[model samples]
Target: MSLLFVLAFLVGPPAVLLTVIGPPIRGWPTTDQLRAWLQQPLTEETLTAGLAIGAWLIWLLVAYTVAVRIIIRLRATTAWLRRMPLPTPLQATASGMAGAAVFGITTNTVTTTPPEPPQPVATGTAAFHDETAPKDHRDPAAREDGVTVAGGWLPWEVAEQVTAAAALVWLRRRRDYQPHPTHPDDTDLTPLPPTVTAVQAALADAPTTPPSDRTAALLEALPIGGLGLTGPGALSVGRGLLVTAVLAGQRHSPTTLIVTRATLVLLLGPAGETLGRRLPLTIVDTVDEAAQPLQPAGPAAEEFSPGQRPDEPSSGPNHQTIVLLNEHDGDEEQLTRLAATGTATAALVVVLGERPDGPNWHANSTGHLHDPHHPNMPTPRLCVLDQTAATDLLTVIASPDPAPPGLASERPPLPNAGPPKLSLPRQVARREPPHLSTPPRQRLHLRVLGDPQLLIDGEPLTIRRSAGLQVLVYLAIHPNGADTAQLTDAIWPGLPRHSLTGRLYTALSELRSTIRTASDLPVVNHSDDRYRLNPAHIDVDLWQLHATIHQAAANLTHTTTAWQAVLNAYTADLATTRTWPWLDPHREATRRRIIDLCAALAEKEPDPHRALQLLQDGIRIDPYNAELHRQVSWASTELQPWDRLTNNHG
Candidate 1:
């Protein structure tokens, strides 16, 4: 009701008042009156009475009602157009205009007519069949001559309507029509593959409704791997179209984009700068360069390189959302992981030109530009983008801020081809380029004995962050994963949740990455709260050491070899760094287990010399333990007789 009042009072009056005010100024309607209703020559009294605010307002209300009815009629006409067969372009246009005009003139254009009386049946129809009447009565020529009606050309509307009705009846009869199946040998019957651009264009211009410019909503509503952009990277026009689509998508967000193709980033960097946007893009130009960040960097560099580019300055921007722009060799696995991880972390991927073996929004100029390796596959959701869209996207890439920096555009690395695919069992097998492909996942070797050390393929692996290693160690100790809150408390205590959350992800990524480098298997997995190490491929020495001790203790008849294995498993005190008070319980438990094993072995051994040796070793580990000291004294006493007898014999 309130909206009605606003529109009725505010909107209606201005348009109506223009008529009364316009005549005296520029002079329209030529005759000083609005219609033929004026009684005498135009005068102030007459004009004032006719143009009274209430009277004019009433007229406007009537016009509004008429307009509503006209709109309904127009909608009906549009419906009719959809069902009707195509007419000549000239006739179609003319009919459309005429229909709309008639509909506007009055709302009651549609009417029902009474059925016409049935034509009289032929006289003596039974006699004619029995040959009782004239035989000519049965002939068609004779029956038509009885009326002798002269025919005339039908009106255009009647003719068109009859023809349309006939066509509709014919169409309905064949509504279930299907094309005949082709012969097996008929190669010509094979379907032609549709290009991505053609498919997308059809979608863009589909006539069900008007095209929407709600591009922002379209982007956010997309599911992971639900959208992609493909075009000839060689064509500048195609490049612009893709770049535009990406920037336009990010317009409503601050999400990271992990671009795998360098050519795309190269095109985007300058375009972004030109558009006044300064995107937070990280360039991993090569595979070797990509892993370098996973490995250790300088202390200062490592400190500042969490969830960001390492080369970035300390005070420079460290954005949460970044674009990974490059299709580096052997990045198929990395990109796949990135797509999933980024999505989990609120990052989005936009593929340019390259056809990733996944479903997404594909934008391409032609089908030929598609990846030859995936020749038979089709990109159903692909859309065609033109130069205009590209230009608009460039504008969108620029930052909304008024001021932009004066930095030179950074050129990105060109894409390098990996080893060719070889067909195996109807699937193309791809090989990664040597430098770009990270090692396949295998069993991990973790040493948490004295100082934490990581070994990959028997070589000392460099660690980038201590926190990540700590997370691994903590998870290793805890077979079941810990929640983020518990991990934060254990790994990065006393830190704010927001700050710690990002750091935790960064650390986790680094750890998982290094684990992949040394051992192809991911060492850790997290769902909601808990993050756990996979027991299958990860071998933690501390875990093994405990197992060894249990097996040795459980054996009823212990062998010297069993005791030796237990001792071998324990290289040093549990975890050398003793800064954490949390380690106290584990440290105490391990020490006590070793002492008990040594003492038990000493008492059970038959050799007095070996017994002395076991007791002394136990004493070395725990000199203050009274039982070990006593055992050592007893062993020495037992050996005294043997020493005296040996001297007497000599």
Candidate 2:
């Protein structure tokens, strides 16, 4: 359409000007004059010449028309013929012929025009329009005829070029403006692992609103949703606020809690206050207040009256001493001093920041805390805190009121004297389960592991640091472990075959060294040109999760306890850093398993409550799953109150 418009606009005027002015300007002899001149010559020769010219013109017209038809047919057939494999020679010939024909047709179409019929005129009078007279404005037919006659012989080359250019422009514009299909609300756009998607979905469906409105909507409606906001400070604050808000709203508390870092508190406090007022919520700034009570001061006398002391010495330690250390600052001295004081009835050590070096304290300690050599040994009460954590130790301390018998009071007074004697055996006397023997003193051991960009296992691992972690995760997922070639292909499918082995070796070596350093466990074993994680030494969540899932699957027909087992199995993304192409199938398989397990639980559970929970969980994990929606509808129907059910179904 555009091409035609451009050609008409540019070429039409030039052709008209040339046709109207050429004869008068050049004073060329008219066709009549030429004919008269020829007639005066030898009659037979002139007549033969005229007939030959006319015949050639007729032949040109016939050939041009035939070429145009052939070109049009070829254009229409090209799409259908493309599916068939043509011989090289034939293809080339066909292409050349089509091109030539198209060119010829275009050239002829632009150049050819019928000659005008002769008009009668008074003798010796100029055939010019009287401009001063009123024009025959109402006669459009006459006007069009006059315009066509005025146009001179249009050049074939120019007209063809203009037409081609316009067509090309039109095609480009059409392509640019092509409309993409609208995405359905049910489509999942998450590029991450299914586990991440599941977690996001679960959070979305929970009664509490998400931290951000945009994120909440995305989580509820879209397949995947998240914020790229980095930094421990922001995450801690955001998470705390979200959790608090959800909890508070569920409890229908008038008070609102804003848990955040000091810097954020400064920035967002006023905004929070304003929001609270508008929403009729109370906002409490918990950043600075959280750390105040956790900090240790000099020991002082017990504040409680003498009679308040537990009867019979409680047959155990009077109070549990928790040694809290900021690992990021390498400040273990404070923790050690607190542990040595012997004042704590039972010590609860909290390590903030990275894991400490080995021989870890638990390994070397002579007191009760010791490593049992089991992969799943009771991870100590050690709470590792990052600088950004919004956890108020005081709040955790205060949360469980009516403190356990002999446990320290929430407001225990600091001791008055210098640090107490550090007699190891004496400390054992005060420990609970009096028969418990003092084990070997272990160094303060903490394995700083997991993805740093994301908090896993209470510590963050940088992307560079997470590569080895990811490798361990991959091996853990593979029940039999992967061979060199398999591992190489999984990790680096795009690499050249020759380089795969080298890259695999490098990754394996680095991974082993990292795991050894982080866990102080001999996790990797090399034998028969393949590497595998030592199941006995490594405590892998993935292994436990898979086992639980399998166990649950076996008992599907019996009971709905399998639902809880399946939920417990899912903890975090399969692997954080490594993007192994081969793992996609495994990841997808696990996702389907989760979906199936949840669906089965929803269907089998006799209690509508359990069924509803299962259905909701399944929906959160697989929002796009048609089965999930069906299950939710069924569960909701079964669980609805009698009155609401009657109204709804009716």
Q: Which candidate is the best by TM-score?
A: 1
Which stretches in model 2 have alpha-carbon errors above 4 Å?
1-467, 518-520, 554-562, 576-580, 638-650
RMSD of 2: 39.8
Instruction: List runs of model 1 lying over 4 Å from the truth.
Output: 1-441, 493-499, 517-519, 556-558, 622-627, 638-650
Q: CA lDDT, every prediction?
A: 0.46, 0.37
Q: Across residues 459-572, which tens digit of lDDT does each residue of candidate 2 receive?
A: 543324223444565666664666777665444332345645765566667755654455455656778867676655444555556566556645645446666776766744
lDDT accuracy of residue 322 in candidate 1: 34
Model 1 agreement with the true structure over 405-478: per-residue lDDT tens digits: 53112221111222112111111122232342775544467888888777766666777676776677777666
In candidate 2, where is summed lDDT lowest over 10 consecutive residues? 145-154
lDDT of 2 at 350: 28
- Candidate 1 displacement at residue 547 in angstroms: 2.5
